[model samples]
Target: MGNAVISSDKWHPVLDRCLTISGEEEEEAFQLLENLASFMLPYEISASPLLQQMWYIIDNTKYDGNDKRLKALSVLTELSMGSADKMQLLIDSNKNARQVLALLLCRGKFDVRQQVLVILRNMLINLPSSIPFLVERQTVIGVSDLLTVMHPDTVILALEAMKAILENGGSPMTPENNEPSFSLLAEEASVHSRLDFLVSSPNEHVALLAMEILHEYIDPNDDDIILPDDLIDLTLHPLS
Candidate 1:
């Protein structure tokens, strides 16, 4: 019983099949992907092509079911956990990184959504240049999906991302052209209304976090906060 050698030549075919197969073969495909990720450690496998395929699979909605997308996201999260530099390089290489992230936030299941949130959190914290791009995407894709979730811990995660973006100066959303993007995102996501919901959350930590975002959104000197009339009404009559 000798240890098996894991190499790109061996794993690439498996990953390639995972990308191409669908429907009746989904479970088999997912298993291959699972094995690839497991063997990725202690073997120094090149993940570039694998990552590209995963993103490709994610973008292709035709074969989106059967937990394939979830498997892809899981592998990505695992890869990212090992190296922040790798994560940054992934973003730099993939022009659609923001688009993929936004789509995942809107479509992924609970675990998938949480992993995407962590990616966003890390990118914002470690790569300041990524702020504007991520902010625009998240605002448009709607953080409300996570913010308005039932789980208190998940709610805290979403709120934490908002706090990071704003604290890192995402509130102003520089370069004037980007300003309207955030406004539309805020309006479409009904962020102000969601903040109202979170402020009264049963979890005191959640409530405080929401309050901080709300405060930053309304900070007197900041010109970017757009409060829709409905948001005003909700604030005025929280019980109504």
Candidate 2:
């Protein structure tokens, strides 16, 4: 295919055009964008005026219902983290982007949200021990639920996210925000509490999921990870 001349002044039209295109053409469009992600291709799509317009459009739209825009956000997220400048663009736009991310998280769009969770957690995990903005400051349920579900790839991502919070949990949390800290007991208690709710669940998957999270983390291969006393007691004494 010939070059799909990227816009210089406005991406909204091109963005809309992409959505209107047939599946093949749209995939081609996405390839063009994703290709820009490679350092070798090097057209600097992030600086494009058209790309800026697309970002602005995504910020204002009801993307929960927009598959095309969701597709684009997933792609852009991957590219924007390739460098400090790009990563900062993502961080700077956190307010505008965070809402959409939260929606994806709440809605459980794992195909996209799972990847994003991994990316975000990995990025923030070792960055001098603090979150970048208000978006990061809020208590998040996404990780907790994922832990309960034992989402295969996501369990590790959730644990990575909680790592910092757990470390910081040593001090008494203000009454309203009683998040568990890294103390092995607190962490185990938090996991156990979530699991307790699932034990009576009709969904065998749910019980099994809880088992996975607990068993894997408390495995002999694992070190210093606590298993809540109740969970251990339950494990040691299964009621037939």
Candidate 3:
């Protein structure tokens, strides 16, 4: 808990032990890694082997149980809350990370899916390059499914992720890569109707976020549709 800076000399051994141990000891090892990772700078952790090691644990679910994997995911989520470089490292370090996270979002338990959404939200906001990968993985569909969760915070997170996607959508990955934008994908997933319902949410924060997402869905060429100045200001500076 001290401000002492963590170095490779200190963390490398812990990383190794975290991967090699099992049972409660392994759980403690992962916990220790999480603590150490929190102390290390995002670039430091992303630059180290720890990132790949965590990815290994996350990708190879057979290597351990859900507890350890979730712990590993937590570490990644923490790392991703940093600069864009760190988020890019999380994706570039593992070829399967996006696919695995998307699959988890679609089929994993509620807690796991929530964690994946947080990570995806970070990626979409921080790393522009991740948009194509996420689009290719049909991440919007997975995100669209979370709008109905009873937890307002989780619902808000899902909406924020969708907002980020729409902000970056419609840009072709390349001249010939004809992948659909996230905006189109969301429409196909019936996210618009879902947002329409959420706009009437009892929680004002949730309702506002839903309205902001709906605003993003508007066509730029259509200038007749207008939002109130206060609503625009509130959306620009979210309560969160």
Candidate 4:
């Protein structure tokens, strides 16, 4: 069915139905959209409208955070992370992935949020072009908020996103014409202070990621940069 010769015109009704779907119909509608994504990717159909519908379906809140909505979003997230071509199309169409990300980051249930994070991490890891779009979307604030959460997994996801931005020269310090405009937001959010507390996180990955970011971005002479003894010891004595 993914190979069907469906024109872009045909997808409009599907989007309309998805936007207005309810109850069991919602799940089937999402599944159909997911199936159509294969064809959509190969053709030049506008993906943003479909993405917008998915966001609405998820945001209705009338759904009361049901599994059906999550299922649809999971598929949408997967589609966003599908490939550079697909993601580029979404970007070109000016589809904002950040709204969907914000919903998952701020309010999604634990498992759903984790899935969203995985999708985000993969998107950043694979698509460097997405950095400006994300940074412009003020994603750093959301990533910083994740650091305050008690869950180490979420913290790791946040770290990975930051790392991607930093490594890709998406940092505030990056010298480029199109740098994201809200560099001050990171400082205002006190992201460094939150990361300082995570330096000694019980999770090794979390601790390491925190240290890596601090090492690169935070001034070594700054009074606020506190290194955990374990992290210091591990750094001083490698292979121990």
lDDT of 2 by residue, 1-240 (tens): 223433233334545576467577777766655554433122445455434544653454554455555556655556444554555555454444555554555464555566556545644453323242312222245555565654644654555554444434443223224533334433443655664465455644455445445455434354434444454321211000
* Regions more than 4 Å wrong, model 3: 1-5, 20-27, 41-43, 63-65, 171-178, 219-229, 232-240
Q: Model 1 over residues 1-240: C-alpha lDDT tens digits?
A: 112534545556667777667776867766665555544543243443766777776677764554677777666655444454555555655677776787778886677777677667656655666677656645444467788778887777677666556556544344335555454456566776787788778887787667667776535354544433333211110000
lDDT for model 1, please: 0.61
Clashing pairs in 2: 166-181, 166-182
Ranking by TM-score: 3, 1, 4, 2
TM-score of each model, paired residue for residue? 0.68, 0.56, 0.82, 0.67
Please give the distance, in angstroms, between residue 159's alpha carbon in candidate 3 and its true position after superposition.
Answer: 0.4
Q: Predicted candidate 3: what Cα RMSD to the true structure?
A: 3.7
Quote the positional error of residue 115 for candidate 1 in Å: 4.0
Error of 2 at 201 (Å): 18
With a 3 Å backbone cut-off (N, CA, C), the pairs that clash in candidate 3 are none
- Candidate of highest lDDT: 3
lDDT of 3 by residue, 1-240 (tens): 554546545657878887667798887778777776667766576567888888888778584446767888888887667666666777788876667887888878788788888888877766767776654435677898999889998898888888878888664343124656667778888888898899889987788788766766634444533555666343322121
How many clashes does each candidate structure show, in the order listed? 0, 2, 0, 0
Between candidates 3 and 4, which one is better according to lDDT? 3
